[model samples]
Target: MSKKINEKIQSIIKQCESLSNDDIESLPNYKKFKVFYSKKSHKTCDIYLLCAFIFGLLAIFTTSISYIGIEHVLYYSYDRIFSINIYHEECLAPKLETLIDIFRPITSCDICQHIDHIERISNITREEFEEKYAYTNHPVIITDAMNDWLALENFNYEFFKRIYRTNSSALRGVEDNCQFFPYKNKDEFETLGDVFNMDFDRAHMIDDDYKPWYVGWSNCDYSTAYLLRQYYSRPYFLPERSESSKLDWIFMGTPGFGAHMHIDNVDLPSWQAQVRGRKQWTLRPAPECFHICKELTFIVEPGEIIILNTNVWYHKTSVVSEDEISITIGSEFD
Candidate 1:
């Protein structure tokens, strides 16, 4: 971090310390601050103390309870006694984007021109991929690999509705489990039926200026995972070490809307298989790699898969086809 950025963060911390709870809650960015604070509370003093006490007492009887279980308990206990908004730093960081613009070098990477295209392969062993691309931060597109996937034939809006709508055990409308991105509003749908009922094409046909909508979710629920696994399996190029089955994610949307520019937080590289329609991805290296790496823009068509170190690259996606809906299944791997 730059000195100016550090000073700005410090100034925000000082201002936050002097603010009362009501004052903090009144800020325009309070909702974002609340989410950030909730994520951070697990690392604070109170959680550490509770974990220490619980683990200490458990040690007297049996070591049955794992550290992972204790960590989850800490995560669930979001109530904090301290009134100060520790997450005020995030609220202020967005505001400093313009002021800290001078810290980045203006020089563009010339190598980008030479590397205009991502590597495309039809058959590659898992060992080859791990050695050449996995940790080295190179991106590759694998073709002819997902030809046998049932997802290519069965996954659609109707399939999702059938699996989730009538079943009482189906998971729906959980903000952390499922998300709906409306073209105009931040409000999400309440159920899977709501998503399936959205007439994206008819809406655009009726109104010339209508924007598209998107729906995305991870297989965080057992029922959802069980249904989805019937259609798709793990990509073959992925090493055995990858926990791809455990962290699967699915994205569904009409052309014109997809994920915005952002970096993912993951311990391993990720791969996304385009099951239907098409998507254009724009990937840029992190600020540290800006000088050495060129920004890449590429299209991923149906039946194709792309693997990249998303944790190191800032990326965004857009639907490329005007009429077709895009459905992508992806997962993180070690």
Candidate 2:
């Protein structure tokens, strides 16, 4: 408060600075003085406990999930997550049949044992498909099932990006309400969202040094599905009494990249409509029947829809041409 006090403080500091380290340490005050510490507070512990409890609940919380012939579907219905009015009844159809089919065991080994080639057919009626191929292990590529569909002429990379741009189910190709498979592009792209975000040249592979990407994801958005359904309808060959899941699965990418060899655990057989480019399907028998069955490869051209029980077949796919990007849309029917 006073000049005298300031002088006294400076003198004490000078004396302390002048003292040797050993002298300062030897002081009685330094030796007897204690470092005061209050008891550890429970506030920090409470905060950590609260955070752990929250995380535990979040871990148990899950999104809607059911098999729809896609690799695996983490798909939920529109009504569960959004306030939008329902439009498609297939979206709300009971998954109990799918669940039952998933657990049902295949009793016959004769199906795969005698299979050697994928049958190609055309102008087949519902009775024909049901009698010959629907319940059989023979994979078939129907040549005319997609002939009347507009998807053959208009479905492409750009068209897909435009329709799904506002889709909440698969926003940016992330798993908002659905699942996405990057396939071979997993190293470079984590999701369909990443592939769509790339530059024009790289995305279409317009240059020599471009990177190739192949991806697949389920279409769960009701509005987007409605737009897609306009371009295509049920295959004429599917049994008239069969049930169709409203969900659609899409695979799109440049040539030289596609899905690797893998077996699916879906509830039923699926069909893939080749809308733009040629794709080769290589089917291998399941491990149990490998000794008796052989691997078969078939090329599906544009406007062709291939129906195979992917659940029992280990399959691999490759783009068949460099001239066009491969685009396919498919769904499961029971």
Candidate 3:
């Protein structure tokens, strides 16, 4: 390689290592990998080095994400020669094309109760919902009907966030409260039961900060056959089902202050509803979008919900207030 190219490659690698938090968040995710090769001179080196670097990066993405358990591997530019096995389950080119389809708007369901609408029925429109329930400056004034019908007290703000940091499917903690049983049938359940030989109720309970987080599928039977058999104590949340057949739920809590940016591996749809406090969400679509949407964040009020596909996008939340409680639920679909 030429001297100039060597200097450039070294510079790029140094910059990649020195990337600031803002710099990382600002750049489109796809371009992030390119930071490895950005300073290199295109003329000096043949494509072989680039291919080698890309392969190395792919190996890194796979290994790193396995530890983080993040499934999405975003790329800025595609190269046929250097790329390894397809990072995603679907074909590479088609995956990018299908992003829009996965994130389409969430429609209202007749059977499942919509807790958000109750905030509106009190003569508050969707437009005014945020301002009225604004968690920062204002208090969430609840009507008697809302308090009673929705079982508002069923939620304990303090307890929920405590559970979230430990119980969430997103975390990579020692306690296996959130286990991944991928089989889509009854046999999978039996296999899981036989291999772990766990009591469904007891197996998922983990001591986090001296408390425990319970785990089970919404569809799983708690009353009948016991896998992790312990007395069921946590709140039972039944997330809305999809038009297909996938089952999932949203996990939101009072993130009191700063939360980190991350993605999930499970192929599911999710949304965050501002239940009690204010939350600012910074979200970026898949591939090369950090360049396009430099200022792509929206603050959510107490009642409104924001739809997000965790599989394809990366998002962060800001608290901006003390003792503020926010609730965001994830919606999973088939």
Q: How do all models score by TM-score?
A: 0.61, 0.66, 0.33
Ranking by TM-score: 2, 1, 3
Show model 3 residue runs off by greater than 4 Å: 1-153, 158-175, 179-258
Q: Which pairs clash in model 1?
A: none
Off by over 4 Å in 2: 1-107, 166-174
**Top TM-score hit:** 2
CA shift of 246, model 3, Å: 7.9
True-vs-predicted CA distance for residue 212, candidate 2, Å: 1.1
lDDT of 2 by residue, 1-334 (tens): 6999999999999998899989977888775443321123456677889999998765544331222432222233333443212332225444343454446565356777777777788988899899888878568889988768888888877777766554445473335566677776655665566666778887677898777778998877777788889999988888989987888999998888889886676788888999988898899876667678888988999988998888777789998777788999999989
Worst lDDT run of 10 residues, candidate 1, spans: 81-90
- Give the clash count for each candidate: 0, 1, 14
Please provide, for model 3 over 134-163, each residue's C-alpha lDDT reduced to its tens digit, 9 standing for 90 to 100: 211111222221222232334333433333
lDDT, candidate 1, at 199:
68
Residue-level lDDT of model 1, residues 80-145, one tens digit each, is 322212221123122232343434334233424346569889888989988876666678899977
